[model samples]
Target: MRAFFKAFHYAAKGIVHSLRSERNMKFHTIALIFVTIAGLLTGLSITEWMIILILFGGMLSLEMLNTAIERVVDLVTTDHHPLAGQAKDVGSGAVLVFAIISAVIGLIIFLPKWF
Candidate 1:
């Protein structure tokens, strides 16, 4: 009980920190809010919501991972190592891939109704 609560508290703190400290997280969250509203306006069914939620989650999770990777790379090699730079760039590329795929999915899901 106490142990579980402690773990939950730390996890909640990390979530709050991530939401506050990460600009990409902020953008993803704002996008998700607008997408949710659009989903409602477009009259998405529950299944559609499930799919959208999955894609959104994938994008957000990948962004977080990219942030983590970049931070680690910076921490290890703050003096401009070429390999570290490549690592950071690769992580960013992963985030870009996820973001683009998610955007395409969003357009596919939402455009038909609006058009």
Candidate 2:
């Protein structure tokens, strides 16, 4: 039980560290806040809310993973290397792909209602 609580503490600490150090994380968080408010205002359906939540979670998770990959690549190679660059680029690409998909989902969910 004690270890389980400590695990949550460590997870929160990592999230805080990432949010503080990663500009993209901050942007994603702000976007999430706005989206949540929009959802509330629009009275999103249960299914829509679930989809939004999943999209938000997917983007945030991918962003975190990208940050971790970049950090690991940096740590592994202080000097420039093609493979390290590729690793970071691929991680960022994954995040970009998810962000684009999330945006499309958001449009599908909110655009018709607003317009």
Candidate 3:
């Protein structure tokens, strides 16, 4: 039980660290805040809410993972290696892809109600 609790604590710490250090993480967090406010004002249906929540989880998790990958790559080598650059680029690309998908989903859910 204590170990499980400690695991949660470590996870929270990692989240805080990433939010502080990663610019993209901060941007995603800001977007999440705006989307949450819009979700409230738009009075999302249960299904829509679920979809948005899932998007939130996916986007944030992917961003954190990308950050982690970049950090690992940096730590492993400060030298300008092609593989390292490729790893970081791929991680960033993954985050970008997910962000675009999440934005599209948000628009799909909100646009009809807004316009």
Candidate 4:
């Protein structure tokens, strides 16, 4: 039980570290806050809320993974390398894709109601 609790502590620490060090993570968190506010104001249905939650989770998780990949690539190679660059680019691209998808879903859910 203590080990399990320690695992959660370590996970929280990692989240804090990423939020502090990663600009993209900060942006995602800010977007999450805005989305939550919008959802509350719009009086989102249960299904819409669930979809938003899933997309939010997906975007944030991908961003964290992207950060991890970039960090590991940097750690392994201090000097410039084509493969390392590619790895980082792919990770960033993944986060972009997820962010775009999340934005589109948000529009789909919120636009009609607002306009």
Candidate 5:
């Protein structure tokens, strides 16, 4: 239990640090704000709003993961390294996957309404 608490504390600190130093974290925060506002104003039913919320969260979660991978890679390898490059690439691929999934969800939600 103590170990779990310590790990949780460590992760919380890392998240706070990332929010401070990462441009992508700022972008994600701004995006989250906009999405929350839109969801509030759009008069969505509970189910629809839940879907939007999930999609919004999934992107942010993936971004955090990508940030974690990059930070860890940089920590381990200060200079250029092939394995470091692959680690970053995999992290980027995770972001791309989430972004594409979110885009599809957005289209599904907004396209019919717009048309």
Candidate 6:
């Protein structure tokens, strides 16, 4: 039980660190705040709400994973290397792909109601 709780604590710590240190994380968090507000104002249906929540989780998780990958790559190689650059770029690209998809999905869900 203690170990499980400790794991949660570490997770929370990592989230805080990411929010504090990562610019992209901060951007995503701000986007999440706006989405939450819009979701409330739009009076999202249960299905829409579930989809939005999943997007939120998926976006944030990918961003964090990207951050982790960049950090690991940095730690592994202080000097420039093609493989390290590729690793970081790929991680960033993954986050970008998810962000684009999530934005499209958000528009699909919210645009009709807004207009």
The Cα local distance difference test for each model comes to 0.87, 0.93, 0.93, 0.93, 0.80, 0.96
What TM-score, computed on C-alpha atoms, does each candidate reach?
0.89, 0.95, 0.95, 0.96, 0.80, 0.97
Considering only N, C-alpha and C atoms within 3 Å, which residue pairs clash in candidate 4?
none
Task: Give per-residue lDDT, candidate 5, residue 87.
Answer: 90
The window of 10 residues in a row where model 4 has the poorest summed lDDT is 96-105
For model 6, the stretches where C-alpha displacement exceeds 4 angstroms are none
Q: How well does candidate 4 score on lDDT at residue 70? A: 90
In terms of lDDT, which candidate is strongest? 6
* Candidate 5 accuracy as lDDT: 0.80
- List, residue by residue over 47-78, the lDDT tens digit for candidate 3: 99999999999998999999889889989999
Report the Cα lDDT for candidate 2: 0.93
lDDT of 3 at 16: 95
RMSD of each candidate relative to the true structure: 1.6, 1.0, 0.9, 0.9, 2.1, 0.8
Point out the higher-scoring one by lDDT: 1 or 6: 6
Total backbone collisions, model 4: 0
What TM-score does model 3 achieve against the real structure?
0.95
In candidate 2 the C-alpha lDDT for residue 74 amounts to: 87
Most accurate candidate by TM-score: 6
Superposed model 4: Cα runs more than 4 Å off: none
Query: Compared with the true structure, what per-residue lDDT tens digits does model 2 show for residues 20-76?
Result: 999999999999999999999999999999999999889888999999898899888
lDDT of 6: 0.96
